[model samples]
Target: MRRDDRENWRRVSRRRFIRLTGATLSLAPFIPLHASAAAKARIGVLKFGTVSWELDTITHHGFDRENGVELDITYFAGEDATNVAMLAGDLDIIVTDWLWVSRQRAAGEDITLIPYSSAVGAIMVKEASPIRAVTDLTGRKIGVAGGPIDKSWLLLQAFCQRDHGIDLAAQNDIVFGAPPLISEKAMQGELDAVLNFWHFCARLEARGFRRLIGTNDAAMALGAKGPVSALGYVFHEDWARANPQAIEGFARASAQAKKLLATSDAEWLRLAPIVKAEGTELEKLRDRYREGIPTRPVAEEEADAAKLYLVLAQVGGQRLVGQSPEMAPGTFWEGMPK
Candidate 1:
């Protein structure tokens, strides 16, 4: 009763312990070894902005999750509103031109830029218009989107003055208005030529408007060796430095999204509604977007930006470039993944 029964009980207990241990080990693969704590990045973007396209792709494909970050997006009605939100510490990131980032940095904000898109507007005319060249714009009524100090407008002026020896600002009847308004006026034949943002230009081009000159070409004429990203992701330098892993993950996720968009026509097809384009308009938008993806090194981009900055400053004056005649140091975030 003592020895044999005790032996049997010990043997059964040992078998039960082994079975439970095996079960636990088998279930371990399904359980999280460590709780997920992905970094949170609050980004502000315009409601209908192109940046939304990439953000959508990143989220839809789980690129952000794959890179160990979580994106919290806020949509704004206007670029100024997004900028204000960023300044008020409501947002950690926003899409804007590096020039604006430079201005902010110069004013002690310590913001930095990461390249986004190089696509810019073009000088477009109706199919039958006689405006064959930049010089032909003389005495013509030109509708300029983004106002007098728009980087595109200033680049156009700089190009004309440098290459054609004509001051376009003085020679042409310039009409400043919103991008959609300018496009509408151009469509109605009220404007002899229109310089609108790339998306508007794509829409106009789909409707048979001819591109007289692209701002990229103008940028080249003004001394940029390659495509220069006019717009980029802007964020506070202190915030980026404190969250290096999150920022780097974001950069990689962004790059992966761009690569997907660049190579996959299927992605563009999915983005058609967001882009508000179709057929020729969609094709133009897709092609232009692919063309704008940054290919050169950061140093090269910064160098070209410096040269373009001088040209912009010459035309846009202190109002456009702010207190800094040159791009502020560390305007482009060097921590970006290669």
Candidate 2:
């Protein structure tokens, strides 16, 4: 042991410590900046193929964390399961329609909704089929999503009754089934026409099927015309009130993501795998996204809702429309962050 040896050892130790500190500092920037500051929001998503791709956009592009929302996303089989989760307090937010929230509020649930999606479903007939107009559907074999209580089905009936002097539920031999199969059956010529969710309908249309009527068109035929985003992001009122900033953050992030998707084909192509979409289905999906994604929340009363009550009352009856001539105040929360 010598003094010089001890000095050399001290220098080595100091050099090792400095290198270790530098390495740690290099990794520090990777930590999510808003992980601590952002509020956590547990969101339920219904996996409707590419119909909910905007949600995928938010996640794929890191919009959630960027906008200060710590997202806890859970996917359900469909809207019904998501609704159950929302009612059971298992979720903070869900992708749903305003009608569901309004119905729950009518039944004394403390539920409210914000705009999320709109103009995303349609009725389709084979491209070569003879069904050219609403009047042409009589005596045809048709397929529909949901059932007699299905909103799209009921909307068709109401629209026909009001404008065409007919009832779709009665004029056609309507078979109720799942959405995916409806498209398949139509492609196979098993049905004359099908009322389906937007993405599937668009896919079919892209493959040479024709839309006899889109959901927005159905709304219009019922005298409720405009680009009303019927679908919404729903939350229990108390959860929304307690986490206003988080809610606003999430809303803004969603808006940013939606705009990104609508404007940038490259973004859509990048995120197409989220829905397992490829090839023509992928392009069709992009078209559907372009058709449905609203540039802004339909905030104007006329365009935002467009005699929305008639659609609700016709589809869901008293159980959904309730006694209110219009949506109860606060039922439709336009509380997005400015």
Candidate 3:
């Protein structure tokens, strides 16, 4: 997004939202584009992820209203659905990867990335399991979330190559599946180890799984100098230009929500009903939040994100995003409201 496009969005009053809803007063499922001139932009979110947590916070606390926009959040079951919705013009912004934006721009899709969430993943196993390290898993069946081309999985391969002198893809019986399956297989003893995303890694830990390698160490293993942001908000350049305030408000309110998460564990408990998360999951959530989320929205070390990109480009290959060595230029958006 351009600097000149970062105008202030007009905040929509609760009265206007009610009026727009016409007595039923619903907040989701059907937010009209011209509703109340509050700079509406539909946001598609995954059932899980940092944006889901933050967006839920923003809406429940009216942070979006304070920041000057009306957010209509649509929940998607998978990342592919979210990306597809963005391409179909059904969603204005969705939490995705810069890598995907690189691929889309290569296809002439006009997608651009803005910083969103960053956390480290892990290769975890049962506490009592004989698998004490990534190197020990030479013949083990490892469950990998997001599959072979997953950025984290690619990073794991990079780590193995640099540190262990072996090909992870060629060595283990890698099962590519969802995050939940990582826990399920690990618990069932069907998988000796599993590589899960940060949030899910926390859940696996809460369930008594031990980390063979954590995110920071995993980054080192993958050849990054430090922690980096792999996920972000993806947008259409044309839509972002036309409704600058909408884009700015989303990022601004999200920053506020990130700050809220950093400051209050009580606030974390408050989000359970909204995100439909509860119990032990809350503790796991706290673990991920405390150790995974950054003090600022952008990673403290900018070089970290670049090192991550290099690993993904070199290791992820054509399977991940179809772009290699060169990511699309101007993918990062610097138009957040001051």
Best by TM-score: 1
- Give the Cα-based TM-score of candidate 1 against the true structure: 0.90
Q: After superposition, how far is residue 101 of candidate 3 from its true place, in Å?
A: 0.8
The parts of candidate 3 lying over 4 Å away from their true place are 1-37, 48-50, 221-223, 274-280, 295-303
Checking candidate 2 for backbone clashes, the offending pairs are: 120-198, 121-198
lDDT ranking, high to low: 1, 2, 3
Better of 2 and 3 by TM-score: 2
The residue-by-residue lDDT of candidate 1 on 1-338, one tens digit each, is 79999999999999999999999999978876323767889999999888999999999999998888899999999999999999999999999998998888889988898999998899999999988888788988999999889998888888888889888889889999999999999999999999999989988988999899999999888888999998999998888988876788889999999999999999999989888877889998898888889998988898899899998887888989977889888888888787
Off by over 4 Å in 1: 1-35
lDDT of 3 by residue, 1-338 (tens): 55444432223465567687775646454776435567888989887656777887888788898767998889988888999899999999998877788778877888877666567688898888888777798978888887778777777787788888878888878888878877788888899888888878777777788788865676765555555667778898889899988888887888788888888888888887764567787777776775655445343334455567777777767777674466666566655455
Across 1-338, the per-residue lDDT of candidate 2 in tens digits comes to 89999999999999999999999999989986676788889988876545357777787788888888888888777777888998999999887776667668767888877676666677788788888998988899989876667666677677787888887777779898988788888888999888888778767867899888877777766665466676778887788789976798888888888788778988867876676677887888787777776555445533446366666675667765667656655567756565
Query: How well does each candidate superpose onto the true structure, as a TM-score?
Result: 0.90, 0.84, 0.82
What's the count of clashing pairs in each model shown? 0, 2, 0
Comparing 1 with 2 on TM-score, the higher-scoring candidate is 1
Arrange candidates by TM-score, highest first: which order? 1, 2, 3
State which candidate, 1 or 3, has the greater lDDT.
1
